[model samples]
Target: MTRLTETARGVYVIAATPFTDSGEIDFDSCDRMVDFYLDAGATGLTVLGIMGEAPKLTTDESSTIVARILKRVNGRVPVVVGASAPGFAQMQDLTRRVMDAGAAGVMVAPPGSLRTDDQIVTYYTQVAEFLGDTPFVVQDFPLTTGVQMAVPALARIFNSLPTAVCLKHEDWPGLAKITALRKDGTLNRRISILCGNGGVFLPEEMERGADGAMTGFAYPEMMVSVVEHHAKGDMERARDLFDAYLPLARMEQQPGAGLAIRKYIMFRRGIIASPAQRKPGANLDALSRAEIDTLMARLDRRLKELA
Candidate 1:
């Protein structure tokens, strides 16, 4: 197994699930999307994430998609499958299937009902027990999960769970959390901290001790470039690149409508054959599409200037 580890850094593009106009999984587009990510310099790929429409997929479909992705990825880079579930049985089953399918690891988000610090810690304790030796990433996206993990709770988790190797840190205003986690003696051991607010606060987060990004922005090359420049100690270049894509990134980060916008851009870029969303998913109207086009145009010009 290509286990994910604390040293994992750089862009791990949260992949989108491609579907045909007829609403079937578009396997061909899945392959193309993987290729596009690799060409964009993605160090890793995360599948079945929230942006990937994991909840929308059936159990059989989820397993099939993971198998197809692992086959297509062919061990080129680590693939982390989102295995969060309402029950331990489902989570464990999914994790076992994906790991058996050759995934590098899994990402588990806290259940939305968890609130108190003890509840959060207990929930992860159960998760750690279920996952056993499988390395997992703790997804700390409070905006969507409704389960805010305080600094002390998070520290307790990291200190206790040996298998918790990385954090998909998406808590808004999470810069201080990163600083807290990186401070001396805060955690029993170090784990990678990657921000995921569509790379909106990536510059500050990086400066605040984040390892990198694990978000699903349409243009992952932008995230890759930002992290690369930051790693090279060129803050100006990093911010310039980030600023060039900020408009589109903001537009793509919309809550309910964001996935449709992202799929449309991916379709326009020829990474996917269609921007079709499954039932219970939103589709972009003419006005939204026009706005995205305008943003893309501005991004193009700005990127050229930066270049």
Candidate 2:
């Protein structure tokens, strides 16, 4: 297994869980999605994240999907599973299962109840202890978790936890925080910093010292291109590509409707079989779907013009 480490970089496309119209797991679509991501230049894959509808799956279903994707990936790239849960036992169990099944690592998020620096650091300390020797990613998504962790607090987690190897940085208005973390001596040792939020701010995050994106935007190729161009010192091309996708990227960042829009686009692009979310989730109305159609058409024209 290619375990995720501090050196990990590039787009780790957060894989979405595909479901049939009747709400059954669409394993065939899952396989095709995996192929699409790899061909799109994703360096790694993260499954069972918030966008993956993880909380909706049974324990058996989650394991099966991870195993299936890992099998499909066949060690082509590192695969990180989102193992965040309400309790350590659940988290530990999932971590062990996926790691043993050849997952590169797992990601854990701070629960919303955590409200202090010590609480945040202490929580991750216990996580590192429970999943002894298993590499993990610290998902600092304050927008979703509601736990505001300053750079110092996150540095404390990384400095203290040898197993914490990467940060899924999703703090809104968080570019300065990235600059802070990249400063000398701010962290005891370096760890990978991959931004989230659908890659809307990816170009800026790269400028602020992020390695790459760990997001679930429908266009993984755009993130891949931006990172590749930036790494090659071609900022003009990077920004041009980023600008072309900005409208759709902004549209996909909507609060409740983002996932629906993403799935619908993937379905339209023939990457998935169904665009339906599971029950108790959001779906796009006809007007919203039409709007997305218009945006995608414009994006295609923009890309060709750039070419």
Candidate 3:
């Protein structure tokens, strides 16, 4: 398998775990989803992310899904799995399993318990030690993790850990952080910076030196186009594509309902067999669904105009 590296760029889509209405893992849908992502031009696929409902899956289910996706991908692109767990042992075990099963690398998010910069740096340093040469992504998502990582602290984590190869930057209002990281002397090495706010800020993030987006905003083709246009130095074209999907992207970014909205969009687009979530997770109601359908219709019409 070609492993993910600090130079990895373009979109590494945070994939949704497909489930049947009966709440069973939908393996068929998983295959279709993989094909859809690659067809839409994803550079890689990231499974079992926080939005992918990683916490709800059993250990066996996680492995099975990753293996299935890996087999389908057949090394067309890198596949990064989330290995974030409360204990280092669980994280290490998952990392080993996924990497051995052909995953490119794993992503680790700091525990909310971390309180100080030293603690944050120490946590990732230990993570690198536990990972033992396996490349990993630093998921710096303070909005969800509740662990704030200052730029310097992040630099320390990246500089001190040779195995840490990417930063899944999800800090709100974090454009400056991207600039700081890209600045000379911020770190002794370069790493991929993939922003993850559902690609709503992707145009700006790309301008601020983000390699691309590592997000699940349903319409991944939009993110792919934005990144490609920006890379070609076409700011107006990038923003135009981004603006076409901004409403749905913004709605899909809502704190609690984002995943539901994304699943609904994916299902309506026929990327998944069902829009079901596991127990304790709700699908969108009729009104919510109607609102999203309206936004999607508007997006389709706008995309045609842009084309």
Candidate 4:
């Protein structure tokens, strides 16, 4: 079993799940992607996260993705595998398999089709218990989860779990609340807060005392650059990079839009096979592609200017 104290920090890239032309899981591409991000200097990787299309993947598929990542990483850095199952039993089972597959930790969101804050807390608590000694990251993405964890609820949940290592705070205000919790001595000093919202507010969160960010868009370098800059005390440069890439970031946030845009950029960078996603989540139509091309061209020119 991976050590419980194998904590990660800085800009970790949550990778986009690669699919083969035949619509099967592309294990080879997954391995390459893992190596690509690690060499780019990601603090770690969170596979099967929202960017990995966790909701759309089957149970076996999720397990396979985590296994591929672990094999590629070889424990060089911690890997947080997503185990957000709609039901408790399935979530627990996935968590066990991921841990068995060599994931350093598991990141889980509140259960699907379940609303109440109490239910969310209870679900996570039980899931944490099932995992025993593994580290758990409470994923808070209000946009996808349809429910947000209030400060008090979060406090209660954190207070209850010894294995809860971090909070993937996706909500800006919620991140603020998390910072507040730490400041006020409510949150344990050991627990880290990883910024989630696609690195959009990373600079701000870092300034406000967030530990790091988890964004899939920064596959190759810019993500590493941002964190490295910040770590070196170049807050101005880091924030500038974050704001300058806001358009690209927004494009990545649009549902049915995020992966496609990232994949195209990766293709332009010569990373992926063709940026061809399987049916139902492929690139935008002709007009949408035209607009993306225009934006991408502008961004590429601007990036060159900065270089």
Between which residue pairs do clashes occur in model 4?
Answer: none
What ranges in model 2 sit over 4 Å off?
A: none
| Residue 144, model 1: Cα distance from true site in angstroms | 0.6
Q: Please give the ranking of all candidate structures by lDDT, highest first, separated by commas.
A: 2, 3, 1, 4
Model 1: residue 252 alpha-carbon error in angstroms: 1.0
Model 4 poorest ten-residue lDDT run:
1-10
Question: Could you tell me how far off, in angstroms, the CA of residue 139 lies in candidate 3 after the best superposition?
Answer: 0.3
Model 2, residue pairs in steric clash: none
Candidate 4 lDDT, 231-279, residue by residue in tens? 8999878766666677877777777677888877776665666677766
TM-score of 2: 0.99
**Model 1, span 135-168: residue lDDT tens:** 9999999999999998999999989998999999
Write candidate 2's Cα lDDT for 229-303 as tens digits. Answer: 999999899999999999999999999899999999999999999998888789888999999999999999999
Q: How far is candidate 3 from the true structure (C-alpha RMSD, Å)?
A: 0.7
What is the Å distance of residue 70 in model 2 from its true position?
0.3
Q: Please name the candidate that would achieve the greatest lDDT relative to the true structure.
A: 2
Q: Which runs of model 3 end up more than 4 angstroms from their true locations? A: none
Decoy 4 TM-score against native:
0.90
- The alpha-carbon deviation from the true structure for residue 169 of candidate 4, after best TM-score superposition, in angstroms, is 0.5
Model 4, which residues run further than 4 Å from truth?
Answer: 1-7, 112-116, 172-175, 218-220
Cα RMSD to the true fold for all candidates: 0.9, 0.6, 0.7, 2.3
**Candidate closer to the true structure by lDDT (higher is better), 1 or 3:** 3
